[model samples]
Every structure is written in C-alpha cells, then in structure tokens.
Target: MDGVLVHEERAIPGAAEFIAALRRHERPFLVLTNNSIFTPRDLRARLHAAGLDIPQESIWTSALATAKFLSEQRPEGTAYVIGEAGLTTALHDVGYVMTTRDPEYVVLGETRTYSFEAITKAIQLIESGARFIATNPDPTGPSPSGSLPATGSVAALITKATGVEPYFVGKPNPLMMRTALNRIEAHSETTVMIGDRMDTDVLSGLEAGLRSILVLTGSTAPGQVERFPFRPTRVVDSIADVVPLVTELAEGDADGA
Candidate 1:
C-alpha cells in the first residue's frame, strides 16, 4: 500500500479501515517502503499521525536495508551522503564514518536541499575512486500536491558528472525485498507486494518470485499496465480492496477443506 497508504501528510481513503481490518483478522502485513527518508520509528510516528496504528517493526524503509548492506560490505568506511537525516543516521549506526572530504564511498539518496555544489562534490568523489551507492532508483515520488523528483534524479546528476553508475540498494533490486521477507519470516509464495508504482514495487516482487498487486491510486494508472513489460499478478482500484480479496482467498481455502 505505497501510495494508497499515505499521500503526503494525509492517509488515503479507507487505508486506516483496511489496516484495522488486517489487525482484526490477525493477518500479517508490513509497510515496505522504498523511500529512505524516514527511520522505522519516524515512520511509525508518521503513520500514527495519519491514523494508522502500526507497530515500528512492521515498518521497513530502504534506508535500513541499505545500511545493513553497507555494514556487511564495508564495515568501516567514510561515506559522503546526499540524503536526509534518516539515511545519514542509518549509515552512521552501521559503523560507517560519515564524511564529506575524501570519502571512501559516495552514498546518494533524497535530499530536499539539493545543490549543484553537492552534486559536484559527489562527482569528484566518484571520480576519485570512491564507490558510488544509491538507496533507490525511483525517478519520482508522490506528494499530496503532485509528483516530485526523487533520489534517482540526484543519482542521474552524479552519473552524468562522473560517468559512472551507482549501485542501487532498494526495490527492483531484490536486496531490500529479501531483507523485509527475512524479517517477517514470510515465504515468497505466501507474500504479496502491494504498492502504487509498477516499476519498483511490482517489478521488485516479480523479481523476488512473489505475487505483485498494483493499485490505481498511486503513480500508475490502469491504462499504463497494458503497455508495461512486467505485468503484476493482480490489479486493484486501491489498497482497500486487498482485504476483501484475501478474505475471499481464505474462504475458498476453507471450502476446499
């Protein structure tokens, strides 16, 4: 329920009701987000503000997965970040030394205060043999007002300046999905990815061998699906429809029993 969960500061219509229904049924689900701006705690608070009473552990952000990956790859390296506080903090928590001058790795994510100077610094670092890493390659993110350019835009600028592509660590890349699934203890076959965007959310699920459900309430429109190469297993008008579908599936299984 990416876009259907929260559009900017406000929760989408029926989102809270749907989540309440999930809680009522004791069904397991998580808010798996590719946005790296918020930590789990921050996300939990935001959801609470939006009237979605979800636990912190149920909120997984790409920043957390990126930090986990970096910790395993390079335990102690200076990182030059071009992201929000959450991404920076996640890297620091994973034993990485955050630095701007002469860094070992150049990590890029979303930053509201982006500048050409910052992009230039990232390019110089990348050109100086520093490993370039990106949290996610999402080109745009949804807001209540409209869509805004996301981390991928920054990554593109850096790539254009440095002539090198950064390694992406978020959805459509499988690592983030694997981490979330591992944390939830859910098998690929039993899990379904519900999100608004087709390129990241749906494609990521398909790549991870899980079922994908696209909702029309986010970045993707119903008409665009027919032209897309990777089709989701199912499509719905909104996340509100998901609970009923699951109920139907459960009832069918009961009838079979």
Candidate 2:
C-alpha cells in the first residue's frame, strides 16, 4: 500500500483514480501492507488524508493476518506481544489473552520504539518454551532521517539469544497472500497482485498462483527487474499505467468474456 498507492504518505500519481475506477467497476480489492504498526481504521484514515477514499474493510495488514492465524491455530490462546495497538487490538478482537506470565506465544511486530527490556523478556520467554511469531520480515523501515530497525532485526536478536527463529506472517510468505485471498473470497486465477517490490509482493503473488504487476514507483527500479530470476506478469512505470487495465477488465466482465 505504501509504495503502490502512496509514497511517504503522499498519494502516488493515478492512485486515487485507480481506486475510483475499481469502485466504479464494483471490483473487490484490498490495499495490503506488511506494516503492523497501525490498525485498519488507522490506515484507512491515513489513506483518506492522502486523498484516497478507501474503506477500513478494504485495508489488510500483517497484524490482522497474524491474529487470524493465531486464533484459528489456537482459539482463545494467550500471547505476549511487543508492538503497537494494531497487533494488540487484532489479537484481542480474536479473543486472545495477553499476559507476560507463561503466554503461549511471543508475538513481535513493527514499532517506532524498540524496548530493550521487552526484547530481553521476549528472549527469556522463548527460552522458556513460548513459540515465536513476527508480523513481517522487513529488517528495516523507512524514516525521514534514514532506515530504522524493524521487527526482523529484533527477531534476529531474539533468535540469536534463544536459538528460536520466528515464523513471519507477512509478505514474501505466501501465507500472507493466501490469507488475504481468503478474506476477500478471491481466487488466484482471477486476482492480480500489484506491488512495488518484486522480492516480497511479487514473490508472494507468484508463489500463490496469482498474476503479479510490478510498478517502478518505489523500491524497485526498471533496471533491477531483470536481476531477479523470476519476473512479474507485467512491469509498468507506475500505478498510473495500470488504471486502463481496470477499465478493460470491467468491460470484459460486463460482456461475460
């Protein structure tokens, strides 16, 4: 969502028009993000502020996917989480109990601040047999100044301390795309994954059996596409290039083609 629709909280060119076209055509799509720092409502507000009129239900985050996975794997389970309201609220909504004492899982997610005490506790918990889980595998996140240490970096520290590797539940992991597909009742055959990063987004989509489109608006440059052994179904300059495809798909659907 950050790169495809907006870059640094500013709407990318044609992003708003693309969303409008989708809505006008009655197309079902979700704005996906690996960031687990904010809830869907929070993301919706941010998108709206950037001039994109996306609903809360149309935004999906790694936090939501992690919570759903935990709830289904172990209903009413307990977790010791180190993250923001997004991760905590999702787990709570899924009837999860959060506690530091003997929790079933130690869930790690993205946050602006990383607490040393919390990291120590998480390591201890993992050492004590609590399973480890992380929202995303992004090692660093973007900031105005520079890149900041993200969940993956901390997860690596915890793993080194406890010899337990965390199971990540965000992009690059096909489970993330599959879970999103389940939420929208979308089929791999008909779904198209549009992303700015070939490593995570395109890889996930390709592994999930969906067509992938790579946009050069962020992360990936035109020259880098060929460096990857695999390629997206199509490579476009930006989201602007894909807007017409939305109209074409809508027309085809209308004609039962």
Candidate 3:
C-alpha cells in the first residue's frame, strides 16, 4: 500500500483511477501492507486523505495476518506484545489475551518508538518457553528523515539474546499471500499481485501461485530487476500503466461470461 498506491502520504499518479477501475469492474482487491503500526480503519483514513476511496475492509495489514495466524494456531492465546494499537487491536478482535506473565507467545511488530524495556521483557519471555512471532520481516521502515529500525531488526536482537528466531507472518513468507487470498475468497490463479518490491511483494505472490506486476513508484528501480534471481510476471513504470490492464481484463471476463 505504501509504495504501490501511495508514497508516504501522497497518492501515486493514477492510483485513485486504478482503484476506481477495480471497483467499476467489481474486482476483489485489498491493499496489503507489512506495516503493523496502523489498523485497517486507520489506513483507510490515510488512503482517503490521499484521495483513494478504498473501504476499511479492503485494507489488510501484517497485524491482521499475525492475529489470524495466532487464532488459527491456538485460539484464545496469550501474548506479550511490543507494538501499537494496530497489533493490539487485531489480537483483541481474535480473542487473544495480552499479558506479561508467562504468555504463550512474544509478539513483535512495528512502532515508531521502540522501548528498550519492552524488548528486554520480550527476550525474557521467549527465554521462559514462550514462542516468538513477528508481524513482518522488514528490517527497516521509511521515515521523513531516513530509515527507522523495524520489527525484523528488533526480532534479530531478541533472537541473538534468546537463540529463538521469530516466525514472521508477513510478505516473502507466501503464507501471507495465501492468507490474504483466503481473506478475499480469491483464487490464486486469477489474482494479480501488483506491488513495488520484488523481494517481498513479487516473491510472495510468485510463491503463492499468483501473477505479479512490479511498479517502479517505490523501492525497486528498473535496472535493479535483473539483480534478483526471480522476476515479476511484468514490470511497469507505475500503477498508471496498470489501469488499462484492469479494464482489459474486466472486458475479457465479461466477454467470457
């Protein structure tokens, strides 16, 4: 969502039009983001502010995926979380109890301010037999000044201290894409994952048996595509280029119907 639709707070050129095309075509779509700092409602508002009229339910975050994974793995589980409202809210909705006393898991996620005390507590909890989970494997996140240390970086610190690596539930896992497809009741064969990064977005989509389109509006550059061992199904200059594809696909679907 960050790179594909909006870069920071500003909407990418034709992002709104692309979303409109999807809606016009009645496409099942969701804005997937590895950032667990904000809830879907929060993200929806952010998108609306950027002139994209995406619904709240159409936004999926790593926080939501982690919560779903935990609920499925162990219902009504307990966790010691070190994140903001997004992670906490998702867990709460999934009947997860948050605590510091011998919790079943130590969940890490994205937050602007990483508390040293909280990290210490998470490390101690994992040492005491609690499993470790993280929302995403992103080592750093974008900021106005520069890159800020994210969940993966903090998870590394805990792993070094406790010798227990966390199970990340976000992109590049392929499970992330599968679960997202499940959420929308969409088939992988028909789904197209349009994203800006080859490493996370494209790789996860490819692994999940979905076609991927890489856009250059974010982290990846045109020349950098060959550096990766794998490639996206297609590489476009930006989301603007995909608008016509959406129309073309929708027309084909109608014709087939």
Candidate 4:
C-alpha cells in the first residue's frame, strides 16, 4: 500500500479514487505491506492521513502472516521477538508468549530503531536452539536520509552469529501471498495483484498463480522489466491508469446483473 496506493505518505495519483471505486463496486480488496513494525490499526491511520481510506481490517501485514504461520504450525509456542508493536501484538493475539528463555522461535521483524541488545539476544536464542524466522527479506528500507538496514540485514547478522538461516515469511514468498488471498477469500484465478516491485510483488503474485500488474509509482522502472526473468501480466503508468479499467469492470458487472 505504501508504494502502490500511496507513495512516501501521499496518495499516488488516482489511488484514492480507485479505492473508492472498489468500495462502490463492493469489491473485496486488501492493502499489503512487508513492514511488520506497525499493526493494521496503525497502518489504517497512516493511510488515512495520506488521503487513502483503506480500512484497518483491509490491511494485511507480514506480522499478521507470521503470527498465523506460528499458530498453525506450533500453537501457543514461546518466541523471542525483535520488532515493534505490529509483530509483538500479532504474536500475542495468537497466544504466543514473548520470552527470552528456551523459546521455540526467534522472530525478526522491521523496526525504525533496531536495538543492538535485542539483536544480540536473538542471536543468543538462536544459538541456544530456537528456530529462526524473519518477517521479510528486504535488506534495506527507504528513509528521509537514505537507505536504512532492515529486518533482512539484521537477520543476516543473527545468521552469521548462530550459523542458522532464518525462514522469511513475507513477500516474494508465495505463502505470504496465499495467506493474503485466503484472508479475503479471493480466488487467484480471478484476482489481480497490483504492485510496484518486480522481485517482491510481481514474482510473488506470479508464483501464487494470480494475474499481476506493475505500476511505476514505486520501486520498479520500465527499463528494469527486461532484466527480470518473469514479467507482470500488465504494466501501467500508475494507479491513475487503473481507475478507468476498474470503472469499466464495475459497469460490466452491473450490466450483467
């Protein structure tokens, strides 16, 4: 949602209108993000501040996904977590106890301020036999100054210390995409993923057997498309271009009705 629907906290051209169209048509949709620091409620507030009216419940975050994965695989397990409210709250919601003693998993996630002490504890926990997991594979995230080290970079540090590779639970992983689809009860055959990154969004959508559309408002550029082995089903200038298509589809649905 950050890049596709809103870029740098501002609604990209036509993004708000497109979302309104979705609501008018009664189309189910979700705003997705790999950043696991903020809860869905926080994300909804952020989007609202940016002039994008996505609901709190419509936000699907990596923190939520990781929590779901843990609950299904190892219910009520203890975890040593290094992240912010989003990750911690989700784990708690799923009945995961946050602990540093004999944890079943050491979960890594994105945060504005990553504490060295927490990272050290994570490394120590993994060394002591806790399975390692990460929220996303993004090594760096954009900031007002420049790039800042994210979960993946910190996860690398833990791996180097403990010799244990962390399993990532976010975008570019088809499991993440499948969970998002399942949350909305949307069929991959009929759903189309709109994203800006080729590596994360496009690749994951393609892998999930969903149609993918690449928008230029975020990370990927038109020149970079040929560099990737796979391509999105469609490419558009921005969400602005998608508005018309959505209107047409809605009209067609009405006509059929």
Candidate 5:
C-alpha cells in the first residue's frame, strides 16, 4: 500500500480509509514487493514516515528472499554486487563475502551508485565463469517522482557485456512467492496480489496460482494492458477501488457459503 497508500509523500485519496476498512474487517494482507533496495524494516519505516501506519513485519522485500536463496546456495567466495546497501548487507548477513575481484558469484540489484567500473568487473567475472545471480528482474520501480530503472537494467548491461544471463531470485519467480505465501499462511486460492506492475507483481501471483489485481497508480498505465500477454483478473485505477472489489468478493463468498 505504499504508492497506492501514499503517492509522493502525500496520502492517496481514500487510501488511509481503505486501510482502516481492512483493519476493521480483520482481513489478512501482505505488502509484497519486488524492489530489493529496502529491507522489510526499512520499508516499514519509509511507509510510516509517509504517514501510513504498518508494522515492520507486515512488509516484505525481494532482498530478503534473495538473501535466503544465496544462503541456501552456500556461496563461499567473494561476490560482485551491483546493488544498494540493503542488498549488500543482506548477502553479507547470509554468509556470502562481497568483493569486486576474482569473485565466485556476481549479484545484481538496485543501486544509485552503479558505475561503469562495477559493470566492467561484473562482466569480467561472468567471463571468468563466476555464477551470476540477480535479486529480481524488474527493470523499473515506481515512486512519487516517476518510474526509475532498477536492477534489471543493470542485469541487462551485464548480459550485454558478458553474454551471460543471470538467475533471478525475486518476484515472478516461484520461490519468492512461495516464501511470502508461507509467511502469510494463505493458500493460492484464498490470496490476492495487488500491485501496479503486471510483469512482476501480477505475474508472480499467476505463477503462484493466486488471484491478481492490477492498479494503474504505478508502472502500468491503462493503454499498456493490451500489449501484455498476462492479464489480471481485475483491473482498478487505485487501491481505493480495491477495497470495494474485495468487499464484493467477500460478500459473494459469504453468500455462497
């Protein structure tokens, strides 16, 4: 409910009321995000700073899932990371060493400090047979300002430089979705994914067999829907619309029951 909850540090129309409605009804929901720049705690703080009240545990970021995947892979050698502090810290916390030379793996995510030197070293590592891993494949992230290029843009740069495609560990990938679903304890049929991007958020839901809703407030615009192969079950203009749709669905379920 970040961008939909508050746009550009200003609360969206009826967003606070919608959240209040959810709290009043005791509906279970999770704010799942493919952006790896922030940890769950960091995201919660940012949202709170924007005046949207949410607990730290109520938020999830792709960095958390990427850390989990890296931990399981047991990457012992140095890793070339092209991401922000959150991604670097997550990887280091999971026991993976970080470096720019003779690395065992190259991990890519979002960072404002992305440099040509880092890209050059990453390509060299990939050429030297270092495994390439990406936190998420999202090329863009939404903000109050506008759409910003994300880790996927850097990933593409690495791909062009080295001709090697990295394995993605975030949303639209089943592993991350399964992780979030497990945390929420919601089955695919009972869960709904709400987001602004169709490729990452909506597709992740589809991959996990959950119902998906696309909102126009973020990366996706109304006209672009026709160009994509994957279509959301329902399309709304904003999170305010989502509240009514969810209420309708709840009533229908009750009637059927």
Candidate 6:
C-alpha cells in the first residue's frame, strides 16, 4: 500500500482512479502492508486522506495476520507484546493477554520508539522460554530522513542476545498472502496481487500461487528485478497503467453476463 497505492502518505498517480475502477467493477481486492503499526481502520483513514476510498476490510496488515496466527496457534494465549496500537489492538481482539511474565509468545511489531528498556525486557522474555514471533522480515522502514530500523532488525538483535530467531509472519513469507487470501475467500488462480517491491510483495504473491504485478513507484527498480530469480506476471509503471486492464476485465465480465 505504501508504494502501489500511496508513497509516503501521498497518492501515486491515478491511484484513487484505479481503486474507483475496481469498485465500479466490483472487483475484490485488498491493500496489503507489512507495517504492523497501523490498524485497518487507521489505514483506511490514511488512504482516505490520500483521496483513495478503500474500506477497512479491504486493508490487510501484518498486525491482523499476526493476531490471526496467534489465535490459531493457541486460543486466548498470552504474549509479551512490543509495538504500537495496531499490534496491541489485534492481539487484544484475539483475546490474548499482553504481559511480561512467562508469556506464551514474545510478539514483536514495528514501533517508532524502540526503547532500549523494552528491548532488554523482550530479550529476557525470549531467554526465559517464550517463543519469538515478529510481524515482518523487513530490516528497515522508509522515512523522510532515511531508513529506520524496523521489526526485523530489532528481532535480529534479540536473536543475538537469546539465540532465538523470530518467526516472521509477514511478507516475503507466503503465510501473510495466504491468510489475506483466506480473509477475502479468494482463489489463487483468480486473484491478482499488485505490489511495488519484488522481494516481499512479488515473491510472497508468487509463493502463494497468485498472479503478481510489479509496479515501479517504490523500492524496486527495473534493473534490480532482473537480478531476482523469480518474476511477476506483469510489470507496470504504476497503478495507473493497470486501470486499462481492470476496465477490460469489467467489460469482459459484463459481456459474459
């Protein structure tokens, strides 16, 4: 979402129009994000602010996926959570108890303020026998100033201290794509994933058996894409270029009807 739809909170060219085209054609789609700092409602408002009218249900985050994963693992289990409102809220919704005392899991997510004190406590919890889990494998997040160390980097630090590697539940892990597919009841053969990065978005979608489209408005460049062993089903300038394809689908479906 940060790339394919909006980059740095600003709507990319023709992004809102593409969304409108999808809605008008009744296409089922989701705005996927590896960031676990914002809830669906929060994301919805963010997109809305950028002139895109995506619904809350249409936004899928690593936070929600992490919550779902934990819920499936142990219903109402306890975790020592490290993150912001999105991660905490999702865990609470899943009936998980957030604590530091002998938790069932040590859940980690992206946070702007990664305190040293919190990292120490997290390392202690992991060393004490709690399983480690993180939202995504991204080592850093983009910011106006530059790249900021993300959940993955912090997770690496914890792993070094406790000799425990965190199980990342977000992209480029196929688990994230599969869960989002399940949430939308979408079939791999029929669903299409549009993203801006080759390593995470395109790779995850391909591993999940969905057709992936790569856009050039973000981290991945055309030259770098060839370096990757895998490839997306299609490559476009941005979401703007996909509008014609979507319109074709709408027309085709109408004709079939």
Query: Which residue pairs overlap in candidate 3's backbone?
Result: none
Model 3 RMSD in angstroms: 1.0
- Please list all clashing residue pairs in model 6, or write none if there are none: none
Model 3, 195-239: lDDT tens digits are 998889999999999999999999888999999999999999999
Candidate 6 lDDT at 119 equals 93
Which model is ahead, 4 or 6, in terms of lDDT?
A: 6
Clashing pairs for predicted structure model 1, backbone only: none
Of candidate 4, the 10-residue stretch with the lowest lDDT total is 1-10
Ranking of candidates on TM-score, top first: 3, 2, 6, 4, 1, 5
The lDDT per prediction is 0.85, 0.94, 0.94, 0.91, 0.79, 0.93
lDDT of 3 at 146: 86
How far residue 105's Cα lies from its native spot in candidate 3, in Å, is 0.1
Model 5 spans with C-alpha error above 4 angstroms: 1-3, 75-78, 142-147, 248-256
What TM-score would candidate 4 get against the native? Answer: 0.96
Measured on C-alpha atoms, candidate 5 has an lDDT of 0.79
lDDT of 4 by residue, 43-147 (tens): 898889988877788999999999999999999999999899999999999999999889999999998989989988888888788999999999998776888
Cα shift from native, residue 16, model 5 (Å)? 2.2
Q: Give the per-residue Cα lDDT of candidate 3 at 47.
A: 91
Q: TM-scores of the models, in the given order?
A: 0.93, 0.98, 0.98, 0.96, 0.88, 0.97
Whichever of 1 and 3 has more lDDT, that candidate is 3
> By TM-score, how accurate is candidate 6?
0.97
Which ten residues in a row are the worst by lDDT in model 1? Answer: 245-254
Task: List, residue by residue over 3-79, the lDDT tens digit for candidate 5.
Answer: 56666667777676677767766777677777677776787777778777878677767787888887877755578
lDDT of 2: 0.94
- Residue-wise C-alpha lDDT for candidate 2, range 1-257, written one tens digit per residue: 97899999999999999999998988899999999999999999999999999999999999999999999999999999999999999999999999999999999999999999999999999989999999998888877788899999999999998889999999989898998998899999999999999889999999999999999998888999999999999999989999999999989988999
Superposed model 3: Cα runs more than 4 Å off? none
Q: Locate the minimum summed-lDDT window of 10 residues in model 5.
A: 1-10
